[model samples]
Target chain A: MQDRYVAYAIDITDPDDPRVDNFRNLTNADRRPDRPGGKGLVIGEGTIVVERMAGTRFSPTELLGVPRKLNELQAVLQDKNVPYFCASPEVMAKIVGFHLNRGVLAVSPRPAPLHYDSVLAGARTIAVLEGIGDHENLGALFRNAAALKVDGFLLGPRCSDPLYRRSVRVSMGHVLRIPYATIDDWGTALEALAKYDFHTVALTPQHPSDTLADTIAVPKVAFFLGAEGAGLSETALRAAHRRARIPMTPGVDSLNVATAGAIAFYERSRLTEQQAK
Target chain B: MQDRYVAYAIDITDPDDPRVDNFRNLTNADRRPDRPGGKGLVIGEGTIVVERMAGTRFSPTELLGVPRKLNELQAVLQDKNVPYFCASPEVMAKIVGFHLNRGVLAVSPRPAPLHYDSVLAGARTIAVLEGIGDHENLGALFRNAAALKVDGFLLGPRCSDPLYRRSVRVSMGHVLRIPYATIDDWGTALEALAKYDFHTVALTPQHPSDTLADTIAVPKVAFFLGAEGAGLSETALRAAHRRARIPMTPGVDSLNVATAGAIAFYERSRLTEQQAK
Candidate 1:
């Protein structure tokens, strides 16, 4: 029987070493895994996110950190045979092209994308996102979804890659754990969801007939969210089964996209828990 | 009566002009209004925030922007006699030490602080913040407070000043509109709150007996929130009349401070509206 616990610790004093090229120049836009010219690496930062990535299906291919963080992650690293590249903070910062105060980073290749049908198979409540282009907001939405009991995320259009470095950090690494898939066609996606008996709720501030709390008691539900200023596209809104609004003060502009989603998810959780009781 | 509609449009071509000194070096830490050895100037950015400042007690003492923003703000500027300093975007960017895409900026002298008693008076729903030192979270809390009909905010220990430039921008200038007062003594503040018959509910993740929805129905309610990782202090938890929590999925960490506060505020709004209906 092969041993599951394999530890390979490599100490690299040189910042320009090719062995650590995967962790280089992280701030450059072209280095983003989702971009055409970029290496499609899933980067996780900080101890918590790094630990989470180790536990997820996307195993870290390599890690670069100061001695302290490497020691902290020793337990999680024990089971994996990945190389742990130990370097001083200065060398690590030089290699990454920024002062990464988190003192730790792990990089992995993107995992196989989850199928929409699989994500929906046993899901009770989900978030269907359209045009959530901001990485921080997208990550925050995933965090909210995880905390509020939404089962998964279904990306419709214009959503940034959830595995992006900033998203991973901002989400507290929740993006790695929460299952997600992208839809090529909104119309077909809605039709597919309807066939699965999911009630699609489009959240909008404009002319919403029902409050989100009123619409959250369904057996299967998906709340659709949009970008900050433009909101959900008309086609996406029309495709949903129902429209709901989180009641707001009359003169104030709409809530931030993620905050609005959190309210919807919270309401769903509250209602479903009450019903269960 | 002295004319209130005086328009002083100054076109300064030099970045080092002393007249626009107040808007200079915005990114420098020493320029922070809340920091020691800093000029105590409240700065507002973008058209929306500047417009909101015009509508709030924090009146802009001076304004700087491109011609486009100047034209857009004409209606708001008509009633105020403050100097409107217009410059080219390039020149304005040099003066502010960054390429501020917002295209507009406003500066005001800090207003006299609000009294805690005044903030609590006539308020039905309020947020009491402890150790919310993050400027973005502090600002987002104010924005959420404004949207969800929270009447005011009471600052406990270690809360950042909402009037700081980053907070002002993040709050969408809602911090200028929301009434807030600092509490020198938490014990006395609690006593004062009790005199007004406000239910002091501390939101904690540890062993909360009642859910937020269960406690939000009071005539007057105050939700206490702590910083992100370190929740409400032990002193704060004991100081509250009751402890309530937002139920979460097991094994997940607590929600972001601002998001948690928003959920609590949303529940309060929902319950109050339901009762009113």
Candidate 2:
């Protein structure tokens, strides 16, 4: 099975093939953020994301695309026995129930989500978001998290499903690359952060707060952010070890929560770079 | 005209009422990027955004909402002659072609765009975007520009209309507050910026470039950002006085254009603050 290049190039002509059942009802299947079962599959669109999927822990079990993308992705499929279901863009659209301009898509079964302890075991910097109900924001937070080298993400109450189609697209598929887990217990689950020697900093606009620049000194840290309009619950804010602010202009609502998170992550990276120097 | 505060509120039972014509086609109005009159009007949704619209230079000619929102907006409209066309939520939904959960909407005629010289005259820092065709990215850039204290925006080729509805909403109505204009002459516009003593910097991820942290000496600067996928044109990058990067992790595409812009704005702000101290 691990010999030379080989991909089962299945020609899919029928839109209603049961083999492609998981890919149907895509519009509704990708909605419903609250149901865990609704978000079981990790989707990768386009050749780059598919290639990335091939290399990551999340292996692509099925590839659905026009022949052009199949040829484009052949180099990356050399080692895998994955099925490449070639179909016309029209047939592919009918099977997926929508037009996918990316021209190709791959699907991965969900692996066990990384456990909190395992994710935080040796992490120096992390991001925790609460009530970030918007898929784009959640996706952006992951992109920023990956760019700034945050070790992982901790999702709190009311976060949208990270595996949703819009999120995967907006995140440029980074949601799959960056690890995350839920923390419904708020402070109690957050207290475990302290056990990892992480200084949990609550990012807020209120006073009695240190600027992000001033608070990046802790060796291990986790910056907490809430949704943009309805921010962190008071309990979540009070439970953090320190209160930090990004030092914004007066009268402006805080930067979009993900933008604020990017700044925090950048500041933390600055500390790591400085130490290395 | 000043005494119009006591005017009777009109009830609109019909969705197709001509008086509410400015609010029609919420979806298609903002579709085109190149045409001058593609979008119908500057739209502001929700109370906070509506209030911002009232406070800004964009004048709201008509409003559609439930009576409760009318009550909430009383302070902002106390003296305006404009009629608040109060309707039941159902009627309002029919008029707008959808149920606007914000429960209120305001439409403003586009104001004469600010002259480049006038908008640039007193600015210490500015943002320039090229080919940022996504309405959400354009809007979120304004939101970040506002929060980070970037004084103004300069639009280059292929950028979407900043006053488009989704852009306005995503910017939290900051699109109305921040002044922006299209630059027709490309690199020639860099000369006008030079007259204002702006240190023009092009943001790119390419190496052998100055890091954003290293480009902080100039008190007045203009930062250039490209669209998400197709970044700055070669001519745009070449015309800039300098080039800089935000220092991202390996194997990641550049940050979302707005996120990258925010980080650049943050770097500029941090430098300015440090110098002030």
Best by TM-score: 1
Residues B1-277 of candidate 1: C-alpha lDDT, one tens digit per residue: 5432245788979999999999998998666555697887899999999989887789898999887788788778887888888899999999999999999999988878998788889999999999999999999999999999999998988888788889988999999998999885688778878878899999988895588888778899988899999998889999887899787898898899999999998999988889999
Q: DockQ for each candidate?
A: 0.85, 0.70
Query: What TM-score against the true chain A does chain A of each candidate get?
Result: 0.95, 0.92
lDDT of each: 0.88, 0.82
The C-alpha stretches of model 2 lying farther than 4 A from their native spots are A1-5, A30-39, B1-8, B30-40
Docking class of 1: high
What TM-score does prediction 2 earn? 0.93
